[model samples]
Target: MLVLGIESSCDETGIALYCTRRGLLAHALHTQMAMHAEYGGVVPELASRDHIRRLVPLTQSCLKDAGADFADIDAVAYTQGPGLGGALLAGASYANALAFALDKPVLPLHHLEGHLLSPLLTDEGVDFPFVALLVSGGHTQFMAVHGVGDYVLLGETVDDAAGEAFDKTAKLLGLPYPGGAKLSELAELGTPDAYRFPRPMLHSGDLNMSFSGLKTAVLTAVEKARAEHGGSLPESVRNDICRAFQDAVADVLAAKAAAALRQTGLRTLVVAGGVGANRQLRQRLCALTIGKEAVQTFFPPPALCTDNGAMMAFAGAMRLRHGVQAAAPAGAFTVRPRWPLAQLSP
Candidate 1:
């Protein structure tokens, strides 16, 4: 079976074809990151408009890349929600319209499910039941995934995702918009002990984290540094602060991930979402995976770390290969912009 996946939940419009017999055949993506960068964040209306414009061309490109025609797709899968409503609608409408025209089944997939299942695309050897740390621009959470659609909520952020903190802090420090990656790069040139930032809820005895306070702490530190440095934060000082902030986040996540792994007694840890792209976080995770102990960690390739259609398509293939079918058709569809992964039926 072959599934064509469509994703337009936010700044990216992605289309892909996943073949059950062969894995990912081809994928195409159109990122509006540069457009949203100018605004320091995404504008939902503009995102929706761009998806509408890119969906068809991207789908065509994906099919052409696969050397397949539209008639070859056995099903159409699309991100159903847990994102901007208009953006979701753009993908949903396009997917449904195409499915209706093609007489193919439509799989309305959960976006987090897409992220959670993305690891399977990389590690074909990975099995069910593992700890998942999904850190993205909009979400930060720990989950215990047992199998397809079998996810248990371990913990999540009370406020401000890790990526959001990175971007906001970078902006305050006069870095470019969409500053998460840039901030991480600057952090590499900084000395670790030059500054220190707080680790929020490191000892709360649960999985829930709070990053909003950390960003405020950074703001306070930035203010003090500017005042002390003749009204402006110096380059070295800014880099040091960025390093400190990055370390703080990495420290808390590593601690929480260790706890999650221990609590579940699961040796495998899967990290997903945009923040999973941070080199510092990857370095920290790499260190943890080096021991002779029974723990291993996995992260998607940098491109797959963000929201994309390929994950959705790949996830749909998993569901189909495992005979996991959606209960409703296009006529009976519903979008859950705030759906919880633990609420999904396995």
Candidate 2:
């Protein structure tokens, strides 16, 4: 089947074409990071407008690169929610409209399901019945994957997600907007033991996690540093703080992931979403040894780790193959602004 995927969940507009028989045919994306950076964060109005401007062109580019035309598409898949209402509407409306025009079915996919299933896009030999660690800007959770559309929530954050903590703490340190990646980069230059941060919920005896307290701890440390340094934090000190924070987050995630694997008796761990691209987190997961056995870990390509159309396309294809019916018609469709992954089933 040929599926055209559209993703406009937030600051990025992503479009792609996926062929069930040939894998991902082509994809295109336009990130609003630079624009949102000027405002210190994403302005939803601007994001929605940009999605409107970029979607058509990006879809056209994707189709051109795929060497295909609208006539060849069998379905239009799009993110339906758990994201900005306006951004979700842009993609949802476009997908429904396009599907209606093509006289094809529309597949409304859960955003987190896209991230959870992204690892399967690669030939990583990842099978069903694996544990998934979905760490992203808006979500942080562990899920037991039995198969397509069959996901059991293992645990999740009680407050801020790991990525949210990263961005919030980065801003507290005076970093620019879209600070997660920058914070990770700065962490590379930090001394390993220059600072220490608490690992929240490390021993909470559950798969559930928490990062709010960690962010508070970072804020406290920042205040102390500023007070001691005459209101100016040294670059080295800031980098060290970033490192410590990253280390603590990575440790918690790694520990929880291992616990989830043990709980499910699933040796394979599939890590997906934006924060899965973290080098430290990747290293930690790869090195995770649960007792005498080593765990297998999988991750999408770094470029695919963020919100993108390819994962959506691939996920839609899987759903279709698993007998999930698409939306009956494009008219009178609505997007879910807060859908949960566990609510999905084949």
lDDT tens digits, residue span 196-267, model 2: 999999999999999999888888989999999999999999999999999999999999999998888889
Which has the greatest lDDT?
2
Task: State in Å the error of residue 316, model 2.
Answer: 0.6
Question: Which tens-of-lDDT digit does each residue in 193-237 have in candidate 1?
Answer: 798888999999998999988888889999999899889889899
Off by over 4 Å in 2: none
TM-score of each: 0.97, 0.98
CA lDDT, every model vs. true structure: 0.88, 0.92
Predicted structure 1, TM vs. truth: 0.97
Error in Å for residue 132 of model 2 = 0.3
lDDT of 2: 0.92
lDDT of 1 at 4: 93
